[model samples]
Target chain A: MNKSILTKREKEVFELIIENYTTTEIALKLKISEKTVRNHISNVMQKLGVKGRASAVVELLKLGELSI
Target chain B: MIKRRFIKKVLVTSAVLFAFLLMCLIPNNNVLEPTQQLEYVSSEVNKIPIYLLDSHNMLGRTNVAINSKEIDKQARELLEILIKEKGDNKLPSGFKAIIPSETVINSLTYKDGLIKVDFSSSLLDVSTENETKVIEAIVYTLTGIEGVNKIIIYVDGNILTKLPKSKINLPSTLDRSYGINRDYSITSYHDITSFNVYYLSKYNDVEYYVPVTKYVNDSRDKVEIIVEELKQGSYDNNLMSYLNYQTELEKVDYDKNEIALTFNEYIFSDADNREVLDEVISAISLSIADSYNVEEVVFNYKNEEIHKSVIKMLE
Candidate 1:
């Protein structure tokens, strides 16, 4: 049940993360504030329902949206 | 794939995609690039030696090279591919893969539960992070692939002479050595992928994950590797190690014409702090001038009783 819905902005964050981008860099790259970047990551994590950064990565990978 | 897949349809629409699809439907053994060159493709034929491939002409669509050069050519191609994959001639585009551009992959093999990867000494670099990153990148890359569990790295195809952090109990195999470093920049290390292996770095005697945050600003640069358990009753061994460590790290910052001499608490252990202080002075005596040519070496385990011999050498 793919209840997890990611906004286009959240999708951008997810893509950058799998490629090893830090929140600070993601903020700089997207021209957003660090707080907003962190918020998006937090919101994405809440939607995906994962606990840790690594866990969110694993779950997103499980959904096949990101590939190593 | 996302961008390329879409771009291929619109921009390349002028390139006869319908004709290409028809050709593909015809079951011909080739896919034309945008240049429209009919480059033949064959998976089975690629495995055959080139000499045999050259010897025959499409006699009922049979490949022709039938001689010794085929094997040699194929082997050469394999080497070229591996070299390119190494990306040392350039670099792994985004991440900090600390191994040098010229470093050669001497041998890469996998068997049983281990992947034994050997590289040239060029792989050796300065900074604790570089050593850790190269180790992590190589190990994870191999282990991430199917059928690999452990990795042992070799320099110039030989095991390291001295580990970055000298271990009390000798490692059981070549894989245990994390070769010596000579430089100080932390960017020498590469970005680690998944799987956290908390390898302890013996900074003095206390075994712990040497956090490199003091050296790098990249939040993802947190690297750790597993060090084996101490055989001599873990607690005591840890104490003695940290004690020895404390003394070893004490240094004189000659840069500011200043010195930071920390007395190892353990130097007060078997011998009085005085004797340890004498050794510290003697070691620092080797050199501690503010010329900027010589880097300052810290002493974390010396005695307070400084010897004239040490001061004289600094002159």
Candidate 2:
């Protein structure tokens, strides 16, 4: 909805994050490093023109990229 | 001007949306629909490995006892597997007879020469035949685990007054499952150390056999020690040496509330660290807990604390 693309992995991480996973939880679930999850989250925020976590989540929800 | 308007809108919109979202996600003052609350075997992956499932999957091996301080556990698992795969009769709705879906294995300890297995349950009412089958399943099964020789079963966190007649004889014969016994029966009893068990090499694996003679010539205490040492060395030699266990079971007395445990040695060396002491204490606590009916297992040091490591099993 923000005209930005979400890679498959990023999309997966976002879905989990919205499901209330902490950063470490997401890393464990994906079997990736916590730093890698952070990197993707940063990219997600930048692509959506958001500065931080709350806005990124809100923007994703607004664009219907997420479901409750 | 545009930025100020957008910032105001963002704050107001986020506050309302977040409140609404939070309300939806959290269950608070929500009206409930009439619902059925039936329970199923919890599919939680990290739950206690039902002894039956573990044994059914043939975890560890029949040739050796499971020694991770969980023989009762392994036996319970063996029973559960036998029940699920083998099935049972007169089992109640929530009552499982053979494969105990969940059982808490507190600890197995080897102090002096005696081995103690502690479990959390009251197994007295389990049918006599079921009990005997379960014990034999454990004893025979534990023969495959490490750090166990003879076992005293405990249920509901205490020892029983009488062993159920689900009696299975303890055999020293070489069974290929624990290892191999290609020449097990052929080993000569001569030159066998007093009270020591003998094993013969066969088919690339070790086969165990009780010495042809009973340990009658030695003190019962000494035989108990020899068997425990063999058990400690059963699976991982490193584990046997890790505790550096030097104490002997001096006397073990019990009441419903507490068990009095004594040892021959002071049990720690000048070289040992707190961690070593902790492991030793836990091992003893779990073992003693398994052998008696009690809440606390008091050690010989005159009011020493119950070991914490073994207590963690309760959690």
Candidate 3:
């Protein structure tokens, strides 16, 4: 089915993260509220079973889920 | 008319006899004789993980066959296999024992998760380049056995506190914390964090995992560091990572004794088939199992759980 772990918005939020983007920058770049960006990160973390944003980024990279 | 009929009958009889003889002369390819058939006999041979140096001189984990069930016997047997001269024939292709040839195991004693083994002075005869790797192979391989968590080495009855050639300091007691195939990238000794991460390497066509203990100055989460280091791939040409450079970690959520990872579709070798490569899975799972105290790892794509790796199974 070509299923993906993150939605378009969620992936966008993480792509910015790899570029060393902060919550505000990601929110601004994606045109989403800061709260929404945080939520997206939180949702991805919850799905990944990891506790932190950095860990999530690391896991995603290992899984080939996100690109630098 | 009677003579003619008799002659035809004789010819028919002779033809039937010749056909029977030809059939008997031809070998029956389908039926195997009892002696020629293979006998199926089950043995107690077990495949146990043994750490050894590969062709690239990297400490790699591979399995060796042993039939012993007793822990003491198994420990000694594994040690024998780690000695190059003794166990070269026991190893699979592409692996070489790390223990120096002709080094004798003076004595081995195990109790309460600790193993104390004394080796002959010849153990120190390893080249400067392989000094640390020799110790690493011993520590990792011995500790890999269940119920044996630590080891102490003695050369000719004195604790091996230092390497003669490399001059690297050694602790009196050793465990996995001693680290195998280490990579030191720390700027300073202060605030140093050490964690184990696994990378992929191949010998011939067979793929195996190599654990690297990395010392870095960053005090961030160990898992975070592991993923980042893994993403950078391995600096050593012998080692590699299957992680796509573009892959990003979307989120990490931890439950009791388990860590789950959310990733983009790049994690899958076949995204359409929703398949993750075994090499990829082993590289991540082995690294996590070594660094994190988690018993299980759940891999997710979006919200759907794609794969689950039990930590014990990877070992």
Q: Each prediction's Cα lDDT score? A: 0.40, 0.44, 0.81
Isolated chain A: TM-score per model?
0.83, 0.88, 0.92
User: Which sections of candidate 1 miss by over 4 Å?
Assistant: A1-68, B1-93, B126-128, B161-315
The TM-score of predicted model 2 comes to 0.28
TM-score of each: 0.25, 0.28, 0.68
**Candidate no. 1 TM-score:** 0.25
DockQ of candidate 1? 0.01
Alpha-carbon deviation at B284 in model 3, angstroms: 0.6
Model 2 residue B87 lDDT score: 35
> Model 2 off-target regions past 4 Å?
A1-68, B1-135, B138-241, B248-256, B262-266, B269-273, B276-283, B306-315
By summed lDDT, which 10 consecutive residues of candidate 1 chain B come out lowest? B52-61
lDDT of 3 by residue, B76-112 (tens): 8899998887976688899888788889999999899
Residue-level lDDT of model 2, residues B140-206, one tens digit each, is: 4444333344555555555543444432222222121221111121122112112223211122242
Which is superior by lDDT, 2 or 3? Answer: 3
* Top model number, lDDT: 3
| Among all candidates shown, the one with the greatest TM-score | 3
Tens-digit lDDT track of model 1 for B187-206:
31123232112112333332
In model 2, how large is the Cα lDDT of residue B109?
54
Superposed Cα deviation of residue B245, candidate 1 (Å): 39
- Which scores higher on DockQ, 1 or 3? 3
- TM-score leaderboard ranking: 3, 2, 1
